[model samples]
Target: MSSNRITTLLVANRGEIARRIIRSARALGIRTVAVYSDPDARSPHVLDADLAVALGGTASADSYLRADKIIDAARRAGADAIHPGYGFLSENAEFAESCRRADILFVGPSPESMRSMGLKDQAKAIARRAGVPVLPDAEITGDDPTAWAAAACEVGFPLLVKATAGGGGKGMRRVDDLDTLVDAVAGARREAASSFGNATVFLERYLDKARHIEIQVFGDAHGSAVHLGERECSVQRRHQKVLEEAPSPVVGPELREKMGATAVSLVRELRYLGAGTVEYLLDDRTGEFFFLEMNTRLQVEHPVTEEVTGLDLVALQLRVAQGQALGIEQADVVPRGHAIEVRLYAEDPARGFLPTPGPLHLLEYPERPGLRYEVGVSAPGEVSAYYDPMMAKIIARADSREEAAAALASALDATRIHGLVTNRSFLAALLRDPDFLSGATCTDFLDHHQNLLDPAPATPTVVHLAAGLAASVSRRRAANPATGFAAPGFRTLAAEMLMSAVWQPVGREPIPVAYRLAAPSGDTELVLDLDGTRHRFDLIDLGADTVRVRYDGVDYPCAVATHRDGSIWINDATSQSGWVPEPRLPDRTVLAASAAGPVSEVPGTVVAVLISEGDTVAAGQKLVVLEAMKMEHPALAGADGVVQKINVSVGQYVDAQTELVTIGAEGEA
Candidate 1:
């Protein structure tokens, strides 16, 4: 441990990453402080820190992006350094300079290095100058059609029109032919301008089947740096990575050595300090690689690197920022084992990967070693609409890639998350996909196979019903009391099994579940047979209106609450909260009423509803288009139908469920 390292630190970020940094700092005996916006005052990061100060803003630009507020908060809390997790000011060179001017350590690369690598075009130039391979790109101008065309021709067809200041897959377009180049250029410029305040578009050869690989590089002020191998982040949705793993399935020893050496060379030449990732586009067919861009901050997928390298990246960042040399030599850092990380998001995969924001009614994660979940929300926590929808990063590690994949798969299966819709099942499906398992992936994987990633028609009704039945039986068994019932054996009015059920159907109305139960006698036990599962009930009849039921090796105490309209609401045994009956109506047709339909395919807000009720629309006609998250989804009629209803208007925040128009089959009322 270096004695000169900053003693107290302030994390100028929120959510899981912030909590993660604080945890690392505390383990090193360093006090941690936190700065939060109004929405994140009660966030896990704020709660985990030694001191928390509210920055008092709702939006990112007004809060987290306010460097002055962050500095003030850190100064007031007496924090010696500030850790800009990943986003926000993490890559802001001016912020780093400001911190340096204020004599507060910034736990990242220096301002010079950030400026050198922050610009994509500039970074490519630097890579080229450093004798590193780089994909060719064109100059970006706001109003240069001829230049754009010439650039497109130079880059050839199937090229990418991208915003120079883009991140998170925004302001990007892929043109497969010359005819669409102009429109793509304009669209990319417009989106880029709107997203990052920089509409300047550039051209690059779009490798349709390229593997997204990146190497982790660390540096220090004393001129020492090392590469921590590579991570395969090719599994993406809309250019945003959904899954990442270390020791890329494609990169063997020789390729890893070459990529790692180039990564270290780039950082060392730039005198980079702290933790950073150098992204590359690897030609899977040719085994050639090109420099993508260097992320000048700790990455979201750092856990995979940490798991394989057994290195504390945050700690190293702190030490390096304190002007200590990266003590270990290049040979000291060796990649070991295999690790995989899957991002758990609060998004509805079936509904076009739209954000699902609500209270988390129930959350369960496997707690086994080698399987880690980095999440901020817990049971009763809110998945707010204001922040990113990522719920957690579920990581697993093993001695080999196969074992690691299996571990992650098992961990995902064992996990049970309720309340809000999530991408857990989708991630599991992707991990199990044969192509993904075989390392055949690219940035266009999701675009090519959206149906596979986001399954249509939602989960099957049978599966939901089966899960509901199991939950019901488990709930009932929990309600039984520890002591036996009061009813005597000779009593004429024996105890009756009470079951009040509710049914919640997809795209339909709520229904009631009807079932009969017989109370247990002296010898024979109470049994429940539903959905191919047998349940032996252990009934503990507590006096009054309460009973404890035991099923599936778990005890649940339930209080007989009000029953009406063939519906029963019981106070759950474990949570002490009321559990509504499962909805059972076969077809209530709630999709139209509940405003459930694909609003947009891209990240954008709904601008207008082009269809009206009772209007018969064609299958390919645009119904409603949304704008948010920097993309657009043009809602189209999946099948010819009479327009039944329109749920939203222009300028609504529609991600997945902003139903523009509901279409009913012909002759349907």
Candidate 2:
């Protein structure tokens, strides 16, 4: 039985995935409705849908996760079906069952199938029964402090404490010793509760060096299932996948067949429908693999799969939801070429990938064939703390892995995002890493190859050019052409004199620049002198933000924008950086006696105050842990001293560079 019954489909998610689903549904002649929170009212997903509904909530719990509100919105819009794209209530069994009872089609597996493998522990049990390999794990029970300690002892040291109801590396932590075991479990529980509405967790042996591989499996209303090729998602940080590719370099034809078969067997046992992914952790040393968990929904990296297989997975999902059968056999699904994908996020790679939320003053993405951009952002938009910091996903495909990798690298270079710090340069460096190029990728790739994540240093020439641009922008509103005019907010000087300015880039010392007006005539040109060198440049104004500068015998198209930090950002095709007007005097309040106090590098809430006033702390001792954008960062005391002042407690939200703890010098206090 086959019927394309869906005429109007409502997407209950936001960001890139929502936009992705809407595109696919529209291609099949289905009208799409989008539900958005308050912060996402101006997002691309809202504007992409044929009909938009406001959920009237800034947070996810009140908006997307509210099953009743979503269902009501769907009915109000006269929608025939609903699609939960990956996050929010996508895998909530109760929500799926409610949809079935309401006689509304859900573009996913049946509720029974969702509950079968929704939790990690339950999924492992089912996999074990289906003849798939599984690892030994301890399922944690109710609220006993001693219970957590006992479970950790049983699992041994170097254990992984993960949420049973969560993914995306949100509610997972590692316990290295007895001292941090209790705290790790408690933190994981709190994060799990905040992320998945479930505090249940389990303990398992942590593999330090493992590769993550997943098999894509799809089923229909009829009892039929097939597995697409496997994808390698080993390059990750903090338990979240950063980059992914299909047909892993390490897996040959034989191993690929074996993994696919194992994944399909699980679908046969559960009779799963719609789209799903079976994840496994492969031991790089032994070439053996064990089932990790099964995602009961479409994934964030599905574009890479579509690129290689030449199939529209979202279309298949909609067809299956409409009671369509498997019209093609497994032999018809052959993966050709290679594909790679990278997630572009608004995060500071220099600060441990901390989330940096701000406006997108300038946004330009690569547009070309064989390169797909699944983006859900636009200029003049803010990257809010209310949801994930993902701005877009750039995917590339070619005949070989090297070609695909090179294409993705080129695309990243072509992307330009100003006004907020991002991991763009870090992603480019990763593609060029020697180990990555040699296919020596593992889960700890980022950890072991930390040098690859460092932000590139801006060349001295670029900094000088940026300095000139900054100075010129500050004086853009000059009163007269021939006579030099004073600044509007400042007192006028009797005689026109040369102006001096300074430039300060992050992680480097400040630079001083002396500049004088070149002429009183047509195009304004300035002569800048820095470090005993003089350079002259003529500026051609083009609108307010973008400028065309003729310098060094070439015309450069540069965008000048101000940052949240009161710094000026200058960007071009070859370079992008943030520069601030240098201060004349060094602030003494910013430094401690030993220069080792704990300060927050990112804005976050104090989740744990591990130290108190008057407590003796050693070097490298954890003072507090801050939670921001669903990730935890520990602020450590860098020197031996006593805690003189504790400025933060649990639940106190602080801003970047805010002093959270003050450690007294060893001889004082």
Candidate 3:
């Protein structure tokens, strides 16, 4: 067997987490090894590691989750230990045992502890043994439909069918009605089998509106354990955390002490050896919290806790794994201030959060005090579909929650990411939301407050005018590349320069904007003709993809970028606005929102077809259900019509905007 000390560590993970672990390991002067799939050959994590090994295939299952390959890679690199770094195989008890058999150190709890905590059903029983409060749940007996049917009735409506082994919102489905119970069970089973290799599921009563609070607990080989604090992870979409904060807004000292004690009790009972998080669903009305589950590995939102507690958790994990006792006791642990984090994903929010797989042509971040960026990819990289679409985690810290919120919002404004759509604007809006500021956040915060997520209207005279002016400046730079001269819209003398351009927002038609420009008095001025509404503004090109424009007596700081196709994009703190040379194409009439011509917004397998051919349907009736990213989206009938054709079948995966069903007026054929 190898020594307990870790000399070289193999990071069995990818993306932001790999980089995060590498940073801490590097600080300790430890050599780090990285493993990659085919799609991640050029990933930043590979270059940052001292040695990288190809683990074969492109998908996570073929590379990161393959215990044999990872152990082989660690041996090939002559590594002393393996840090699973959160996701793939991080909590897999079998993999931990494999590492032990191969004489390599596993930087986590013992395999027995992982087995006890990996399954929610068994973990709940363990929590009960530790006197931790748990939710009322029923286990499914075998795969019998009758058993599940009986269990469903006992648990009641608005319940969740969760995988006995699950995390990250996968392997779960919400059953709101009895009619949907069977489908939800089947779907959840499929996802559970595919994601965790475990089809065992159970029924848990779902809380309508609750706060997700998790306590960070750490233990060592000596059996001494302590709790850090609580983190609020209620702000979520698609059942995944989008924003998190340390020292929860609502948790007082009394509640914090209680939650922390319960978590520490569990850790000590398990004899856990490293970083772990105990999650609970806190009832907002009653101040009662029930144990949800325990993650036997580090969480994605651990940085927020680190910011407030002022500790490098990954470093601590390494030390504990080396059989060293925790340096500080519970009394030594203290939280300084508030810390907030938001996940930036490569997803198109306007298109139902569809993953946009493409290259990142430009990636710029906000650099300021109290702002920390734990990123995955830099500029000129590809965001593939083989893994999670999360690109970076932006964390901000301050003495007060309001100050932290404002600072993070400002930083988000200064950041620019192009080549693919992201949820940056949605996160910006969240920081500015009044309800969020007032701490009225819960599990369904996004579900109830979707208006805040929507971008401001792209119409009105000023918006169109701003688009035109921004486009003109970008076009000028593209032409000159040296100076602002020699461009079609540039004016050498003080004369009005009439310029017109078309701007097309994605999923919308082209908008033609005409404006006049002049360089009078050595200052650039633009007069936008908004259908006879003359609005004047000053435009200044700040080098390095930034523009400062004065409009309506207010200066707008916009990060601007020119794509390879000559399209201009602009993003600010709260809204993302852009423009491009409108293409001269055939015009088509737009359909009403209730029209049936709208296509699917994301690529997913057709799980259920609710309508039949030649069947009359209401305008809002469900036509088909598609499953993508482990979430279900229903295609509704946009207009009252008879179903003409169902173009997809169950188990068939279809791309975005693919025609799943066709509807026509009765007897039209």
Candidate 4:
């Protein structure tokens, strides 16, 4: 490594990946330039870089994907080279060519090689020519239904209609019969047109139980290239990978060698330079493999490969792009141990992987050995809806696959993220699953064991306790007059005040939990007497309605409330307050009436008002249908009431217990 050769490098990306590349460059005493969009002007990546330049707009197309803007930023920042750290413009061959034209080195494969390998169909053709086994398929053009259907039948009934320009599962469809081939192809083409602006599609045999395996390959300008190892990326959802591990579960020394050799041969035949990945689908039952696709740039799951290989792929990319020869031979790149990386995303798996965007009030990871964390943001940072929802990458390494699984499980268990929802626990569940541990997973692993991936009992008890403790700390802070007058000023005369607090955890239920807390005066201990169980809390003053509390020797994340009514919510900790509301049963009364009046029992949006005004209705008959929280519930007639007047209409939003229609007794009906 020479100073003059690699003094300055520009990272043409943002978020965690950009920061990650900058870290590798800085480790080698290389200055790093960060490029950011308008929204990311104050982002962590921009702040961490030695120099930063604005890329103008917030959208990917206007910022990171704009080759001219990126090149100009690099030139202005005095960067000698640009590293497209995965995603955005990383796989764009034209961008690489533009960088070369500007006399700014691009830290990746040559443009011509990238162009050859970036297209899935083109890459498959190249693989076949290089003696690599490829999936049976034919590239299709034009909208002629008959020709396309004939092509589909030739590939077989159970085949894939894939968009030539598609990735990330978009524009991919599985057709099982000739009757549905036209529709599948049309839909795939439309989606491809929208997502990648390329409607031209191709056909391929779809393997039901295929395991996604990819070989990590590196090349240099000196006609030298070597394969590092393989990564298992079978754990996926909607065709996007959720969890990845190196030294694939099904691949041993023999399979690894075969796959690695094929990957090296494919790259050399294409004259590829810099780092790339050659993905394959391995049939678990038959041990047969076929070329899937080629990623012309670094992948999101590269951390897993790095963990097992102990090599910095980014550094190698920079060196190779500068005309350096491959330093190590294939025999020297033996992968040792097993490594697993779980992508902690700001999305809720329970809600169909819906993005969960909010502020990161608290972010903490364990300092345990063998666990490596790559985070892009810190506490109080926000995960907006404008970008990919990945919060962090939690990687763990161990001597064996079993050790690695256990290590990852422990790491996830120790991870705590508050304020914003994350898939931390969900990822932990996958790592701890028996099938995942035994390497008995396929593309349908999550679909097969949906219950395991999404536990529906709400937050874990430990997390609840932690949030409660944090809330308790906030209560203590508001209790003191000096801290804040938010809490009722310490009343020396009153022993305890009757009060109740409502807490809505995960924005679902409002639990009417009442607690009796003792006043604090240094000697008096704050105890939370809930449901006859006593829990002690140690509150540390942090000034102004903000206190850090330790329950069971663990600090909890908490916040304070401005008003009374017991509405203060602590994230994952137990808290104590001076409010004790006695529980009393509601008074039951029997009303004697001659006629019945119509009323809605529960309030919800009216999906359909089954009965109109003057419509006859029988007793206990269905009157209206209401939809609440995406679930439908029916409202029935009580005591043979008539639809005297329709108060609500279909598709009208109503409150709880709102009257939908008026009803009378049987005689009136």
Model 2, range 1-669, lDDT digits (tens) per residue? 133499999999999999999999999999999999988889999999999999998768789999999999999998889999998999999999888777788999988899989899999999999999987789888878687788888888788999999899977998898788777788898889878889999998877778999999998878889998899999997899889998798999889889999999999999999899999999999988999999999999998899988888999999999989867578888889999999999887776777887778678877877899988788877888767888999998999999888888878877878767888878988887789988999898998887877746333355435434534444564534532353322223323455777776633357777765443455646567778787777666533356666677777777766654566666666566765566444532344333548788667778788877889999888889887766777888878989888988897878767788888876676
Best by TM-score: 3
Output the lDDT of residue 510, model 1. 53
In model 4, where do residues sit more than 4 Å from their true spots? 1-4, 144-148, 175-191, 456-502, 507-669
Question: What lDDT score goes with residue 295 in model 4?
Answer: 87
TM-score of each: 0.78, 0.86, 0.87, 0.75
| Model 1 collision count | 37
For residues 351-423, write the lDDT of model 4, one tens digit per residue: 6665566566567777878888888877657775446778788888999999998888777765656664577
lDDT of 4 at 157: 61
lDDT for each residue of candidate 3 in 1-669, tens digit (9 for 90 to 100): 646988999999999999989989999989999999998998999999999999989667688989999999999999999999887899999999999999999999999999999999999999999999998889876767777888888888789999998888877888887778777787777777777899888999999889999999999888789999999999987678999999899999899999999999999889888999999999999999999999999999999999998999999999998989989799988888999999999877666677665667788886898999999987877777667889999999999999999998878777777676788878878898899999989998988887866666432336434644555565666667675544333565435556766666543456666676655665566777645567777776633466566777777666666677555666655455544456444332233343344466666667778778889988878788776644566888878888888898987878766777788887777
Tell me how far the alpha carbon of residue 156 in candidate 3 is from the true structure, in angstroms, after superposition.
3.0
Compute the lDDT of residue 25 as modeled in candidate 4: 90
- For candidate 4, the per-residue lDDT at 176 reads 86
After TM-score superposition, the amount by which residue 11's alpha carbon in candidate 3 deviates from its true location, in angstroms, is 0.6
- Candidate 1, residue 658: the lDDT equals 44
Candidate scoring better on TM-score of 3 and 4? 3
Model 2 / residue 493 / CA error / Å: 14
What root-mean-square deviation over C-alphas does model 4 reach? 10.0
Candidate 3 segments exceeding 4 Å error: 141-149, 457-501, 506-509, 514-548, 557-559, 571-575, 583-669
Looking at model 4, report the run of 10 residues with the lowest lDDT sum: 583-592
